[model samples]
Target: MGCCVSLFSRKPRLEKDHWQHTQNRRSSSAKGASALSGGGGSSGFTEFTLAELKAATNNFSSDNIVSESGEKAPNVVYEGRLQNRRWIAVKKFTKMAWPDPKQFAEEANEVGKLRHKRLANLIGYCCDGDERLLVAEFMPNETLAKHLFHWENQTPEWAMRLRVAFYIAEALDYCSNEGRPLYHDLNAYRVLFDENGDPRLSCFGLMKNSRDGKSYSTNLAYTPPEYLRNGRVTPESVAFSFGTVLLDLLSGKHIPPSHALDMIRGKNILLLMDSHLEGNFLIEEATVVLGLASQCLQYEPRERPKTKDLVSTLAPLQNKPDVPSHVMLGIPKQEETPPTPQHPLSPMGDACSRMDLTAIHQILVMTHYKDDEGTNELSFQEWTQQMRDMLDARKRGDLAFRDKDFKSAIDCYSQFIDVGTMISPTVHARRSLCYLMCDQPDAALRDAMQAQCVYPDWSTAFYMQAVALAKLDMHKDAADMLNEATVLEEKKQRGGKGP
Candidate 1:
């Protein structure tokens, strides 16, 4: 790992020229995506009338409300189901005093166009006569905070928690590219999980702070130092909020950034990790996350790592393979007794469901295929030598992957794959990720697709394909691939056939 960059060091902000280039690229992407997908709504958004929203939310019944309560709350969220039976979340700004409805809708439409796998994409908006509302894809799995702090059921596994960090960071990084827009009041609550059990940043985060009001929901301790001192938020302020979220993930509890910084400086982050993760977590990975979190919590806004840096850092820490949302979130599956099935539950099933790629690798490394008999046909010496060779190559790959030496890791994994000692989905997945890091999207996509073909039930393969596709700017296709991955994941997690 590289030495931590000092947070106090000021970095140049994205200049106007950069913004112009970004906008041009965005326009090209939209055109390309629409042309390639043959769909007009590549943005995956819509516009709604107030009456339609009212109908979807049962006339804004109290039972449908999802956020804080108040007769005239400044902003409130409601859970709604559109006429098409698609579940959605509606954010109504009661106090937002936009003078022109056309201007408000235009601004809302601009936000809607900003889409990414990690964002809860804006589905539509309603700006009718004094009513201003934005509708988003409803996340049934609820907020990250609910699982982290208020879980009445099983807590999320270490892998799921780590994935959440990656998802949010990716979302923010995409936002930065779109226009370094201010993501006000970013916290665990703003991060929600989709039906596929993937984490998504709420679209509301992109709303300009002026519209959301100056008051923050969290304590001053958690607010960025700039916001605390100047009562103003900049792009860096959003980064600071991201840092607080990182702290929350590391500690498994909310700790003020100042106090968290004290722990980080003292190298006592191990003491802050969630007690539940102690036995199940990897020390090395946790240390990396803690270090990154500490950097994010730096006092000077200039010192903080930007969303792009966070995305780069987190993309690797998301080590585990993709697990179905239902299993990761601990959502109960519907009971069903299966008749005779072709693909019975294998040892790999449970490990893969939990995203325990390490365990899967160990199992694969240990596995020795027999010649159609339940017997070790090889001589003891020959078997031992073969095992040693396989283990050595796998170890090399693992080390290279951990060190972020994607080229070396790809070489090592390729050697193992060529030998064909044992069938392992994780090797394919890992190599695919390495290919992505090496900017070989075609190879990455190929490997990911091959992995999926080899293990149709594995969600990780689909996720890899999604990443590769996104890199290629095939956003619509990537989304479709992700949905497929999520479906297969959900089925496998529920102990059903991959449909």
Candidate 2:
């Protein structure tokens, strides 16, 4: 037997056979549990539950939709936070996009195995019933398209643009080396900025957006010539798409490949450069990139350079290696702000009055919704299915709150509120803080108002409102609310009912 055969057995078992066996085992186990455990190189990959995902995205609310095309896209990507406080981008596929759940899970697992600093790595996936979703590390700053094409404040600097090209090329090369050469719709949108504003290739592009194999969603002008004829994606096709992205970086607009080639042919390189750069870019670097773009956009796929070649050609052009991407790109550096000093008050009152989110979060975690214990007052006769569900949701929210899982707490508390059973000001107050901790001051404000509606004289309600207002930058309103809360607390302590 050749190297392909197993040495221990006369019966031949190829490498593909071994892989298939492992995949079968994984698939079988996945069917038994709500999620598949990580195996092989995919140790970090998780098979998330539908309930967990629904809770993360607030039941796939449109408000959480983060896709470039928004709700109009067949597959919508939502920004979400897991119970562990990790932020994720959830791509929810349309119904029956992957009819075979096994295929979906396998594809997800294969893609999840790839992790690199250059990639927005796949974290997990959910294949519950007819719903199919892929979760990846959230890229906070936005896509290259947003910065390049629809820039509001300032366009990306030359150094930042070069960094994007070099980084994405390295990403493509890394993926190709790892045996995942084909990337669907490799465009500017597929390049996203992480917290540090570094460009990372979205792993979502590795898997076909749907099982139907309709890969390219961009305009036909930007698509590779081979794909138009053969209706399939190949490694060369991805290279051609990368060429279009390079043109986007150079021209600062979507220029068709054919049109851009004519400009390159006519020695209009200067005109092709982004006018926003104002001749700041080095001539030698621009010419090198233009030459590469011309070669990549060649009509014959065989004439185009490989992913590694692209990386080699672009690597030396990077001049700002020491500078952080956020600094080069003009994005504010993400840093923790020191808490401001505040006057001393009751523990809970002081935390909220100071608008110290960390202190308030700690208070909520310690309180464990004790104040809401007797507030609902559900009797045995009134304990129907809806009431049980409402209470169960509140119980779940309390547990999550105690664990400091604010996202889950928000979801469970929202469920309880939606049930519209017996109201509890404490539940609203707790959820208000959950929203605050989650950085949703508007939602926190709404919940605080709801708490005030339930119990107008509740000091916690006023305090939460104050905190939310302070977060929203309405400092005057926040100070007034804080003073009102102090008065209410004093009245309640002095054996007088608060107004």
Candidate 3:
């Protein structure tokens, strides 16, 4: 008789899992840090005194607190204007194990050296006795969550949403490359819009993890699977968290990866799209984004895509280009509020139809466009061939545009347009967006007008034209264009032929 295979007779030899190895590496690194004399063992970093920080923050008064959560926790953040009248965010940490002033200074110095365009640059740090604080460049705009999750203003356009995702990925990639392999608590709140309306990742993420026993304020549903399993994070863990942010952009809600993965695999992604994105977002792009998110959310940490890959993949899907971070983040207008859209006509739709000619002319003058050779009318078969060529050219443009290669997109889209076989409104609109991104508002307006001429009743064409008109300060023309587009859209919906 063959030896009976006993159930649970012997346990398999244990192999160190990915998280275990990561933890080991982290432990060794910490030991290495501890061995240094302090400074995180380097120098050249500004060290602010406790008294200086207190004065800057008005003695840590409640009035200066800037954290939206309104929590009086040990880790509190304050908005302070420094001596030179430069605004800075001051973070006061409640006491923990960082007692060695030299060691704390050293760590802060090492982290402070981390600088990237996407990061809110770290200005300095303070570690005076029991008091520990960090100072960073102040971001005028609020957190990404306030814009994407709960905005009082207009929701970010599909293109801007895509851009934000790409920006964060690039920021994470920068951190990993700079030797700070792990970003603690990567989330929407950590991304802020600067004065120029560009998104900047909070450099405060470079600080050591909280020692005061506080954890993430967000729901665990969005946390990486590895973090839940081992109570630790790796670079891959940050990627997993980023995947959740993508989900938020796509669905406008916090959803568990397990459920989201199920929907993705089932080809039911349309059900998960944000309602606000209806008619604006493309199914193909959404699928690609979802695919990336799924890869990032993979169960095996090793299987997750790297930050480099994430950046490369997302660069092409950016629809609208150069949208100010303030606009995308819904930064409150200081004075005049723009006109709100009537029902059935979205704000963007209205804005586009109204036309911003002054803005358009300003943007137009900024870019140089190739002459429009003009398209010739074609027979059905010839049109089909032209369409194929147009699509191929547009495909190249889309990829270039996603990568923020505006010049290339313009060239490719121009080729498609010059061929002039297909009357594809979307292609025209896409090229217009590219033109706008490249600061060629004239080119943008031209494309928008061409789109309208091709598809007389399409709202997008009118909207694009209106944007150009409004930008050019042709308010009357812009308003009229917008009214025409709205009326046309309403007429179309009512099953009429034309306005």
Q: Which candidate comes out best when scored by TM-score?
A: 2
Q: Model 3 Cα displacement at 230 (Å)?
A: 2.2
Arrange candidates, best TM-score first. 2, 1, 3
Q: Order the candidates by lDDT, highest first — what do you get? A: 2, 1, 3
TM-score of each: 0.59, 0.61, 0.56
> Tens digits of per-residue lDDT for model 3 on 234-300?
8888888888888988988767888999998898988989887766888899889999999999999
Highest lDDT, which number?
2
Q: Write the per-residue lDDT of candidate 1 for residues 243-287, one digit (tens) a residue.
A: 888888877798898788788788886788888775688888888
2 versus 3: better lDDT goes to: 2
lDDT of 2 by residue, 137-174 (tens): 78899999999988888899998999999999999998
Ranking 1 against 3 by TM-score, winner? 1
Against the reference, the lDDT scores of all candidates come to 0.65, 0.76, 0.64
Clashing pairs in 2: none
